[model samples]
Target chain A: MAKPTSRADSSTASAATEAVLGRGAALRGRVQGHGNVRVEGKLEGDVAIDGCFAVAQGGEVVADVQAGSLDVDGALEGDVTVSGAVVVRAGARVVGVVRGATVSVEEGASFSGRIEAEFDMPPELGGKAAR
Target chain B: MAATVIAQGITIEGDLTADDEVVVQGTLRGKLSSRDRVSIDAGALVEADVTGASLSIGGQVTGNVTASDRVDLVAGGKLVGDVKAARLTIADGASFKGNVDMDV
Candidate 1:
């Protein structure tokens, strides 16, 4: 009876369904998944996920990343394409084109790339274009 | 635990180097190097050279394995590669076809 209960608890723990790349870890290749991921290490591959992605303070990524949302607190040297939002926190360094629905770079974050946010064309811009 | 888990349905193709433990339940097709334990859960498919402190295989592995501590091939596991470890154990129902180097 106690073992069954423990198994149930473990199953519930697995329900969190998030992947973690811990500190001192290095992954070089393609990472494709359906759940969110938090990186606290080094990743040198393309990542395509259906959930949010986060690069922790001590983490570094050198590959293109695609996710539902992205939060960076480390160094990223590749393009990023997100369906939701992209946030670059303080002390982060990102050097690549960023495309998202909403993108935010914190004050202390260093970013050297183009940002393409999807938005409807304003009426003034449309009028100017027509003229 | 704060170990890394390669959840089911996910596929990783490349080299993975970790200082912490790793549990794989998905598909991994590359090199796995860890300073801690590495576990291949049942139903997982791994085709990579593995180097770790300890290794527990309950799935299918098709590469060389080098463990500093020990290697355990659990029941229903299938391994088709050489093994280099200090200690090794093979369960009754496991299938293994490889040379084992225990360093004598």
Candidate 2:
């Protein structure tokens, strides 16, 4: 596809603006951005963002997600990779592998997925010694 | 107020649907559908089939458009697609190249 014309000023402003998928909206493709994003509806494609990503209470996602951080309060059925943290809030239902620096699930959240937290292995486990 | 905004510099590929208003200021491809108004702001670029209750264009759109109420092509807007609406308006400075169906 041809690239969109870039206006320097607009690009800068866009980097700081948050993208919101409104309450009843839905997206079925790839979304790539440099700013934070919030979803309150449905998304059926992969999402890659340089900033935080959130799924609101009524939102639903069925694709892979990658971001700086992730906060979910809705339904997600895809793998997630976050550099910072992953928080599944109350009433959220997620079903996929989750990889992050920290992963937490609220009391009322429903999650059925593998959680991968990156951590340095201690030398006693032959981690550093093996290396 | 538009509940969803595809802010400047963002790029979306595929389909988008909403129940409320939507404003686009960036690049979007595939399809766009809204139950309410849809606005394509100046400098924005959209290449998709768009459906909404009302539509106002101030940017560039390349595809088919279906508006239940009205369609307005504002000044400086450029559209290259078919339009279907009950009412249509094209500003003096707007550019359009498509077929129009007012549902007569």
Candidate 3:
């Protein structure tokens, strides 16, 4: 088993909490941090999350996003960068660029952008490269 | 307002827009915009550009943050990016590696 990390390491390894952007809210600018964040409203700018990032089906965002993992169940117009994976659900609209180790575009999902990435298996997932 | 905790079962990958009083307990990967206090609970994972009136972090996040008010880092929080806010507080147990641009 892997060695356990200290409280300091744990805190550094993980930050923030589950955040949600209620419906009807509108925003414009830059946002960056670590944690799980959800948007069900509207946004126009740049966003980066360290953990997981999700866009609710009713949410709409126009900007660039980077994160460890991504799940889109809403509408997004911009670029995406992910260290882990990107999952685009049905009825989702995405227009921009994306770079990630793994990307999953669900059926009925529309996408218009450039994709650049190389999948790399995690340390915990050794000898598992199914490309 | 509530305790912070971003459970791994949840994942968000897109842009986010929020209003007053927010507590993250899931995963958010995108741009975040808020008008009031934005909290990042422990176990929460976020990667996005952030904007809020005030911010309280307790999870893992990357990117920049621009707060009209102040930005606070609670214990068990990890942030890696730049910040633009009037005030920024990093708790002793908080982990952060980034730049700070105050007076914005």
Candidate 4:
């Protein structure tokens, strides 16, 4: 059998600005930084990052989040403000207000929140008057 | 592999509980508890009371530490709090300013 090398390579490829909250771990506090963070466990509190933030499957986060971008594949219950896009993947459960450049909720994802996205309309669509 | 890793450039302030090993390469302020080994890597800054099965510090820690196994302060490590463990070792070049209790 060929050795599984991709897993090892990907783990080593993680940059210094990347952090992981693995499964079986729980944190009740505030995480603030200029790096990306992936949550695979339980987090309760506040998260403020200048980079992307992701919540993996089986993960749970109950806190306000401010990030460059947000991706959820688990459970998130808090307001989120992102400078980039907010993607609620399948099987994800998200609640609270979401403010981002773009917000997309895929099928199978449960989201109950108001979305605030600012985008420019095309000229053919009545432009700003369409608002 | 450690389950929880606080990577560099990140700062966490609060309580952290884990059933598995934890590795810190960032800044943490609060309490840390783990059922397994804990490692404070070089360049990390920890200002919290730490409780673990075993601990190895190569960075700067400014709180009391309690370990069921052993505690090792490697070279370049700096600790400024009390230590309670069964076995403890402070390597040369490590700076320590705390009381040690071997539980004899």
TM-score of chain A, every prediction, order shown? 0.83, 0.82, 0.78, 0.81
Whichever of 2 and 4 has more DockQ, that candidate is 2
- Tens-digit lDDT string for candidate 2 (B23-65): 9988899999999999999999999999999999999999999
Q: List, for all models, the DockQ compared with the true complex.
A: 0.74, 0.79, 0.12, 0.78
Interface RMSD of 1: 1.2
Tell me the spans in candidate 4 whose CA falls farther than 4 Å from its real position.
A1-17, A123-131
Error of 3 at B31 (Å): 16
- Candidate 2 per-residue lDDT, tens place, A1-131, comes to 64556555444554567788999998999998777778898999999886778899999999899988999999999989999999999989999999998888999899998999977678898666432
User: Which candidate, 1 or 3, has the higher DockQ?
Assistant: 1
Per-residue lDDT of candidate 3, residues A1-131 (tens digit): 55566655444455433555567566566556656567777767777767677888988988888878888989988888889888889979888898888788999999988777775567578956655
Quote the true-contact fraction of every model.
0.76, 0.85, 0.17, 0.89
- Clashing residue pairs, backbone N/CA/C < 3 A, model 1: none
Preferred candidate (lDDT higher): 1 or 2: 2
Error of 4 at B5 (Å): 0.8
* Top candidate when judged by DockQ against the true structure: 2
Model 4 TM-score, 2 decimals: 0.89
Q: Report the TM-score for the A-chain of model 4.
A: 0.81
